[model samples]
Target chain A: MKRLTRMQIPYRVWMFLFIVIPTLILFVLALTNMNLYQIGAFDLTLDHFAIFSKNEIGIAFWNSFFYSSITTLICFLIGYPVAYYLSTLPNKTRKILVSLMIVPLWSNMLLRIVAWEKVFTADSYFTDLTGISLNLIGTQTAVVIGLVAMYLPFMIFPIFSVLEKMDRSLHEASKDLGATDFQTFVRVTFPLSSSGVISGVIMTMLPAMTSFVLPARLGLGTISLIGNVIESKFMKEVLGSSGMSINEGAVLSLFIMVLSVAAFMMITRVDKEGETLI
Target chain B: MKKRLWKTRAWKALGIVLMSITFLFLYTPIIVILTLSVNSSKRAYSFEQFTLQWYVDVFRDPSITGPIVNTISIAILSTIISTIVGTLFAIGIHSLQKKSRIRMMILNNVPVVNPDIVTGISLMIIFSLLSFTLGFTTVLFAHIFFSIPYVILNVMPRLKRLDPNMYEAALDLGCSRYEAMLKVILPNISTGIIAGGLMAFTMSIDDFVITYFTSGNEYMNVSTWLYAVLGRGQSFTPAAYAYNAMIFAITIAIILFINLKKEKKGKLA
Candidate 1:
């Protein structure tokens, strides 16, 4: 006990109080039939898991997964080339580009989504200017575009940093071996910087799967992603819904948690360090 | 060889074009928001004339002030607390022998790896268990809670890059562990600490998920305020448009400040 590092004590205490116990609370709340109104009335039941059967919940789950996956895929396709290009630029240009990408995150993201919402509306800014009805609002395309716009920076920076610091010697050696530029990229550069790619995907996908703001605003409150489902469960009790389904909310929470941790583990198996998470 | 040179040139042009489009896409939404804020008329999408009426309206609105105050205050407060505790935890976790270090790492990973929704509700459950009402205090704790792991993640790598021998050398020179850490280790990792604090600030400022669940209806941050208006199924007030403009202005100021400071540091090194 005396040998415990002094610094670890305070943090350990914090972890137990904030982290460990709360996790227990998640399982306990989910596994039990605890209603929101009567916190006291508790029964151990798996009824919360029954949300999986409802087609709406299932569709929402699938929608969240699909949107996030597509968002991630699109980000990579666009972001990788940008990152790769930035990596090849001079230091000053690279720094400017990278910082330019990141600075948007500090501003209000909701406002940005709201801006997209307006642009996609029936009388869009585009339509107002050009007098054409694109009619994109409330569409999946709007949600996807909103998400991709918001999350692209997150995807770019990690890959850029990784590629910037890559071993130039390896690339030179591959070229010396008579490898073409495309071959060198495919065999050497992509494989080496995959850690960054993995980190980018994980970062983008997690928030993408869990974001309610993009779906709600961009979809005009019509889309029902899993995040919207979870949010509605919480948002409804306050907005005048009976029986908050706090237990069912917990069930969905646990499900998301399980999916996320599994994704992390699977990603980590390929990339143990995943050093570019930020 | 000429053909190959032309081909490479073409590819470079294509990549640049794609990159430009990406940058354009990234910048366009925020630019539109900022441009729309100063419109002469609220309903008019065109720039028929410019007006600061929205700005005046935002300055006069009572609800805007509370949310602005709450958002900035929460961001600053949580950044301070999380940076301190998270830096110490990074040091402590790094100092430990292997077995317990792995355990601590896994625990530290929870807040990072867990979806914000899970973290929010779980924290919600605990706060409820402790009979703490959902309000400013719970929101503070929630922000601090999530921000710490972020700080830890940022600082841990810096700590890992430090040479263990430096600490031993300080101890051999008769310094206490605390003193050695302060004099030798802290200087090396201050950059990481600063970066982590910046990230924490950025995250806390932008946060809506955890803050939404944990903050009672009364304690409104910038995000929750915006969300509340959106939830009512109405577009933002013209005043809210002005507020978004202010946020963009602050973001630009921050970017310039960080860049100048980084340049100064680079020159020094």
Candidate 2:
């Protein structure tokens, strides 16, 4: 075992350099006045904290929470029944159905966003094929639709896996003890599957909350989440603009990171091995 | 009792209906892309006619081919490196005491859970901090950095299932430690390794965010390239649709082929 442990030293170094060091840099940049352009001399200041005072920041936060909550709620509504249905199928059918569900994921996500963008625009292929021009571009509804399409699988898989692994006799016992079907689900099945539900919510909500591209494309530049704010800030830095510095981006990133790390902790508590993460 | 049974059947029917709707939601955009790929229309906004010219154009167009080559190469390179390195790391982590192993597992899950924007920014800061040139090498490193965790995630469960005494048994039967590992352990965990490798490949290929930030000005993968042209109004090619459609087709083909092979093998056994 000791000899085997030696193999991880290289990986540890890799993680230290990549993960640990970068995280520390993110914290340092977020806390200080260090600019990406002027990396030499800088003093610690709470100046970046002023970003939170901006209207865009406030709206970004609201939009992030609003969109993510709606998306997660919708996914749970749609996904829970889908997962339960899949769980009831025979083994071979379930396997085939689940794989088919996952196949869309193997395709490029950006392209799917682009596809949705095309559909939302007036005079789209959808209109051409079905004579129904949605013209839904630049709307929150379009963004949410794209999000649900993108992340529905993330919700369904966790719940389905947990439900499948559950002891069926529990449900049988609940029914035998004079429980109604809905009562059995409410009291026994749903409670037992809470961990999977948590995993699913975290998985769906985190991505929806922090997503940049999905909103950028599907929202048609009308919507702004915390992700877009962070992206534009970094883009400004990359494009050689000192205004809206990378420190501001770092602060925003750290803020988002805090939320994500909390969610990750919740997942770790429920799923010790992260079996449902994929 | 009859009324309760009727309600149960109604619920089941509703489930099937919702499943059908969800499946349509998932597949509609894909079907759109597939349709637009063969459409004779130059504009993706509206379909003009059905034709295979865009598929032909995908081959002739330099813009599409260049990014496709970059995406594939980076995906292949990162997948190979991450798969091998991550398998070893999983073995090493699995060798640890339970307390430390859980800590390591949590640490490994960081990249998995962190939003891509943050990961991208953090890596960008690190590369800039170290003064490493941000290009293909930096992008490859970034991919591998994020990818190894997934590989570890996939392989760890397989490692937990392996019999710990098998290695010792192999050693006692005249195999060297390295030989024991190669002959005994790696073979047992080959499926996980392959699955992890496949997963790493898929992630690397589809990645846009991290690659966007890390690739700098000189390089662009398919995703970043699509993004760059997305705002350019008319220069965006329908060939992109063709390209995505082709990749979708190939993936479905590969999966179907693999399933057929597996079923044939199962029948043979």
Candidate 3:
């Protein structure tokens, strides 16, 4: 057993206060009936759960899920090819390309969302060119577009890492056996990179589901994803009297937490299945 | 053989085309914003003429300046605090036994994977319960909350790779634990810390969702200010574009510097 140092106690206590305490408060607040101004005695109630079951919340939850799923799918479709292409490049070029990809990540995410708003807002150039006025600014389509754009790098990076480590001989041997390039890619490359694909999908989907800024900004406050709903409950005073009931927000929070956990579990399970197949 | 060669060339051309298209999609909006910043047009998104008036406006306007200062202050403070705390926590965690490390690792990753909205709402709820005022302090605290996880994750890998015996050697030479940590551990992990700090600073500066929820209308960060502006159905402000360009330029410069440093280190090694 390592000896516990005197200084460690204060550090551990600090962590407990900052990290664990907030988490506990979130749980208790989710369970109790409390308003923003009234910090009275806690009464445990399932009213929040009922609120979640009612109109708008259910629809919002479904919308958040479907949007995230579609974004993840699109990210996978686009990112996989890019990842594959990057993996095939010479080392120096590959390094430069990877660096370029990550450079955008360093920029502020909100800034990027605002940049998209510039593109898709009514009377923007895109609308003019297409002739079809895509009212994308406040639609689910805009949210999906933003999520896919923001999360593309997450999908690409993992797949690129996996592809870089793939055995070159497999492809060469398949070619020598007179297999076409497409066949080799389908039979060998796709299967081999499945773990990365699973991880990338998970990484993209998990964050996409919970994202607030992009959806809230582009969705024009018309569509309330779980994130926006929760924010409204806690901060906007739109749900209950003077900042929606904490208990309701908390119940919704628990639902979100469960959804996220389930999404993660599905990803891991898929990853395991892919690994076994490989 | 000629046909095969032609096919290979065609494939290469296709790959390049695909990559360029992707790049266009990724960068056009940024380019558009930068261009509009210099455009002489009062109306945003309509290219009337070219001028530097927007940059001038951003500098001259108090409303813009206040939010810019607030964002910079919060980012700088959060980066500094989180870097210190995260570096210390990472060092301490590295000293623990392998068997006891799983829980700590999971806890460390919680902030990153937890949805930002959930985190924001939870923090808001918790702070209000504790009677913590929603202001600069609350925002800073919230920023630090997420920032520390990134810093710790970045620094810990570097710390683990360090030679454990180095600390013992320093202590045997009569150096105190603080001296050993400062002299030995810190230098090794400085790069990771800097990288993490830069990331944290950018995230905090750019964050709107968490800041929006926690800020409580006390003061405006750049993002929150922009949201308010945009919500009013006003055209994109040229000043906002200029501000964004400044942020973009800084981000690009940092990335280029990091890349150059890595290359230089690679060559030296």
Candidate 4:
């Protein structure tokens, strides 16, 4: 390791203060009654946990989980074939297609959601054509759609990476043994791509679970996912009359953190188990 | 044999259909926004005619213009800062031993995988506690914070691929440490730096959640501006559509330019 110089000290201090300190503050706030106006000078309290346990919080958490799970499933169903097809294409064509998949990702996320809003709103062509209006704008379906659009590339890239690296000889051998193409894929290709599938699932699931913007925008202000609930508690009206206490917000944030950590652990465990089985 | 050939062709046709539908689903909303931006009708969805009036309106309107300028400025500045800092971190981390490298990698992954909302609120709370006003500076900082990890992730992989012997050879020739780094190390890693910078700039421009929390009432970014306008239940104007189309067009142009440059270089080599 390079020895630290005087010039490096200031940069190190800046990182510690900005990145490391903020994370530490998050941990501390998760445990205490750090109110909006007061900052609660070291007063430890578990009252916030009570608020987090309420039906509203539980329901929001469940809804977030439910939506993310459905989004993951949909992405897997849609992305798998596209990934397999892309893998079979010549390299140059595959690159162009993959680039198209990523182009939407480069645009502003909020604008992307707004584009969907324009698509599903009452005046949209879908509504115009069907005449029976589907209220997708402020529903759970909108959230799921937004999530699928946002995370599709994440799913595709991982699956593509695995598929691209897969040995074609294995598929040929499976076919040569008198198995049909479908049988070859089911028995050989799908199992080999499980790592990529796991990766895509994790990538899609984590972001979808924690997404605040899409839901807040498309799901309307009243629709509270875990993320929306946390944001509302922290920034919207924590000190006001209608606002819950700061401790309550902290507890909710803590719950989210716990859930995320557990999910991470579960993913890692799955990866390890998959590796052993393979 | 004829039946098998027919079945295979049918399967291929099915594959194409499935792929096309997926692509349509992914891109239709964006395509709608682009088409509607040029539509002459006052109504949001009606496609009676087409015009460039919305593009004119977007340019002429100060409210829209200001946010667009702010978003660009923030993105450019954050890209510059993050590229420099992230490159340095990548260098520093690369210099570490194996165990510490793993630790650094884990530390870096936190920002990438952490929920944007969580990072935003945490930064918001910290900035408020420190008495920093949530405005331009806060927005810039938030962007830099999020962008650094991406830059580092992109750059570090290239750095790992770099051969250490080049530095040793430079030192053996009696070159100064600074010269060795500037002449030998920087050139080899330039592509990684450029890729990282592009990614960082794109992320900074595209970010909404963190920008929302850190940006105070004093200023509005393009994303925030769009959000506010959409929330007010205003009719979709052609100008708004043109502005969005412009964003999409710029993205396509940039990607094309980059890919073309890479292809030309490959051909030359």
Cα lDDT computed for each candidate against the true fold:
0.81, 0.87, 0.74, 0.75
Off by over 4 Å in 4: A1-19, A40-42, A123-135, A167-192, A220-222, A242-245, A263-278, B1-14, B41-45, B232-238
Q: Sort the candidates on DockQ, descending order.
A: 2, 1, 4, 3
The candidate that wins on lDDT is 2
Q: What global local distance difference test value does model 2 have?
A: 0.87
- Where does candidate 3 clash, by residue pair? none
Highest DockQ, which number?
2
Weakest ten-residue segment in model 4 chain A by summed lDDT: A269-278
For model 3, report DockQ. Answer: 0.35
Per-residue lDDT of B251 in model 2 = 78
Q: Give candidate 4's TM-score.
A: 0.88
Cα distance off (Å), candidate 2, residue A237 = 5.2
The TM-score each candidate achieves on chain A is 0.90, 0.95, 0.78, 0.79
For every prediction, compared with the true complex, DockQ reads 0.54, 0.72, 0.35, 0.42
What is candidate 4's CA lDDT for residue B52?
84
Q: Per-residue lDDT of B128-201 in model 4, one digit per residue for the tens?
A: 88888899999999899888878877777677788877877888899787787789878889988998898899
> C-alpha displacement of A110 in model 2, angstroms?
2.0
lDDT for A98 in candidate 3 is 82
Can you give the TM-score per candidate against the true fold? 0.92, 0.97, 0.86, 0.88
- Pairs clashing within candidate 2: none
Cα displacement (angstroms), candidate 2, residue B31, comes to: 0.9
For model 2, residues A32-108, the per-residue Cα lDDT tens digits are 87776558777888888899999989999999999999999999999999999999999878878887887888778
| Worst 10-residue lDDT window, candidate 1 chain B | B40-49
- Cα lDDT tens digits, model 4, A1-278, are 25312323444565676657866676676566565445656777665577656898888888888988999999988888888888988988888888887786766676667767766577575454335445678887777787888887778787888889899999999989999978998999999987778778777887788777788778776567787777677766664774445556666666666665665554445442112111
